[model samples]
Target: MEASSNFLKRSGFLTLLMIFVLCCSKEVNIPEPVQAYEPHTSKIREILFIGNSFTSFNLGISYHLNLYLANDSLSYKPLIQEAAFSGYSLAVHLTNEQTLAKLNERSWDVIILQENTDIAVNDTMATLESIKAFQELVGNKGTLIYLLMSWPYKDQPEMLIPIIKTFEEGSQAIGATIIPVGEVWTAINQDGNPNIDLYNADGMHPSLQGTFLAASMCYSHIYNQNPSENPYLAGLENTTALYLKQKAN
Candidate 1:
């Protein structure tokens, strides 16, 4: 009788312990599954611009591009970001920690690389090497790489020849698309619109019109659509904006 009673007590305790454990488990909250970090929604296209002052001047190309996109009735939205600094070349970017961090921050849909104007003209080999390095880093992420061709100085029109050649060679060597911004600027110059000035007083940096033109060209090539179609004037006069869009198209 004593053994049977002890057995029953032990069984009762064991059952009680299990019940307590089960109750505790039911009361405790289990965490939901962790999701990966996504910077933008699937409906948004992210573009990262890596360049120098030419890219950042006048609030940057991405700024105007966003303005154009915002005014359009497109299916997908665009989110543009930049890691541009004054006088920073592709070679300099490779060595800079901040630039490296920005490059690896996210899987961008498109990465636009603009080399320093002087490096592209004088050191084509270096430019190609930097482009190759960037290509390797980008890998097969389905990200499109493009070179934003820099325009010639306002006073030195002859510089455009070598600059164009360098960008062409770099694009061909790396299998990247060329934005041809410089070419567009050259065409605009030939058009002889005194109302449109592409260069800042320094003759190196781009003026507001130059930046608008660059942004328009970028919009045209990146979207495979005509910039003239987009009604965003980017704060410019209607006639001037229309003229720039026509040239970009």
Candidate 2:
């Protein structure tokens, strides 16, 4: 009987030990499987900006474009250069020696043409002719040509209508893509009196916010992605940047 009792105690102790071991195993923290590290496949694209002060102001649209590309996780690394002259029209660029030189400098993957706001609105035919000429310069090199539709003067809100019409007409005529930046500006302005002004003091050129918004639109159109996803603020307040992105989208 004593031997039987000893066996029972031993069995109980072993069972307790097994239960304790199982309980400890359940409490043990197992690490999750590590994901494989995948490197970004880097691609460099040469982009040329041919426009006026609207494209060059606030350190140029290309500058902000590069910033967005650099900050984003995308594989594209932009080699951006601009031939921007203040208050110059696309017609003037067609004749300018520097502009001609830049066109021949290299084969650009993309060329963005931003016409002077006044010229685009007032001389629509002239703007269309210049766009055609620029396209000819780009040649059949498979270079994607895009028109950067600029915004109207802050006080002269009526300019937006003609500007949009001109750009849309030019895009159809020249087979170039329209960035529709002016439309985005108009939408934001009409939505409400936004906290961030889209115009500079001259009520013509873009403010920093305006430039950022333009850049966001460019990035969205070119990359075929949502600009709101990009984290680069371009020195604007977070909320302002977000507003511009959402509006651009």
Candidate 3:
């Protein structure tokens, strides 16, 4: 009877070990998880511009960007949506229901924001508040936001100091990136570049050359590509285009 009991216990233990080994040895086919598409790629598909004439002037930001990209022989062509109104402040956009609605209208890869040129200097708090609100509204939607730091008035170059400060504060507060267009203009001016005039007759809006520079900056930021390689001239002389593109890069 003792021998039979020992035999039974040994048999049971062997069976259990065999079962565990069998279970562990078999390959379990867990499907590899599908990767989500990233929006920030070498090929940016959609962009939403939210601002005033600073973004839409001189045949529009969209036009110049597309022209540059297409001329560069890129595989992807971007679809740009502009929600810009001339002379509108960030406060106006905050109160405008249409602007809020437009945020949900599409899946934008990038949303570029340009405030009224003077608002950042004159009313920094209001500008910062609106930027914060917009950033919150657009942040979670999987879109990158960029602040276009426009140039100060031509006559009042001193205004740039405060304006740059305001944009810096606003961008830090909201975690948005800034495209330093104003800084670029300042550099060109301080360097004594005789060929580049970035402003229109109003001294606020950009000239065709200014728009080209702005567009190149936008393109570079969005696509992660160098702007100098682009072939689109935007009617600018080759030397001027090359200079602007180099600065934009």
Candidate 4:
């Protein structure tokens, strides 16, 4: 009887071990997630946003960007907080030691800059010249430059055409990408948002909804992800679609 009991106990232990081994042996393959953009080969070092009132839309675009990125994170890019101010001249930004200190202290992976609205629109050679100087000063080590294109002035929408063209040229000169936030807004604003204001009360800055839209557009490109994949895009798409429909009506 003792021998029989020992045999049974040993057999039970062997069965358990076999089961555990089997569980560990075969691996289940999880579908590699498809990113809207290819897996980021490089991590984003830092993102510096420089613009006048439009870029500074203060807790507007930046806030909404964080909200979307924080909640629905499906990208491989590192978190890069924005550093900028409203009505900031390119020359002033270049001369500002504090601003330079931030870049010098940390290696920025990307810089999305926007010249002041007037400077960008007024055909000011100085603005572009300052940008050239600033670019050189930053020592273009491993940074990607980009221009943030803002929306048309509600009162003078035509004034934006030249500016947009010029910005494209400037971006070409600097080897930077362009985030056409203004065009995105124009597409969305065709529909009347009865109570929801798209631009700020001043009609120059972006309203809450406007900021969210800008954030969504920029985030989509920067992270190489599509907004359709983004959860927030649903709302934005719905709003834009409705706007288009209303235009048809």
- C-alpha RMSD for every candidate: 17.9, 3.5, 15.1, 9.7
| Candidate 1 residue runs with Cα over 4 Å from true position | 1-44, 75-77
User: What TM value does model 4 have?
Assistant: 0.70
Q: Can you tell me which runs of candidate 2 are displaced by over 4 Å?
A: 1-44, 73-77
Order the numbered candidates by TM-score, best leading.
Answer: 2, 1, 3, 4
Q: Ten-residue segment with the worst summed lDDT in candidate 4?
A: 240-249
Number of the predicted model whose TM-score against the real structure is largest: 2
Q: Kindly list the per-residue Cα lDDT of model 1 for residues 176-224, writing each as its tens digit.
A: 9999989889888898987898899998899999999999988888876
lDDT computed for candidate 1: 0.88
Order the numbered candidates by lDDT, best leading.
1, 2, 3, 4
lDDT, candidate 4, residue 70? 54
lDDT of each: 0.88, 0.87, 0.84, 0.65
**Could you give candidate 2's per-residue lDDT for residues 73-132 as a string of tens digits?**
556556999999988999999999999999888888899999999998899999999999
Give the winner by lDDT: 1
TM-score of each: 0.80, 0.84, 0.79, 0.70
Instruction: Report residue 202 deviation for candidate 3 (angstroms).
Output: 1.6
Clashing residue pairs, backbone N/CA/C < 3 A, model 3: none
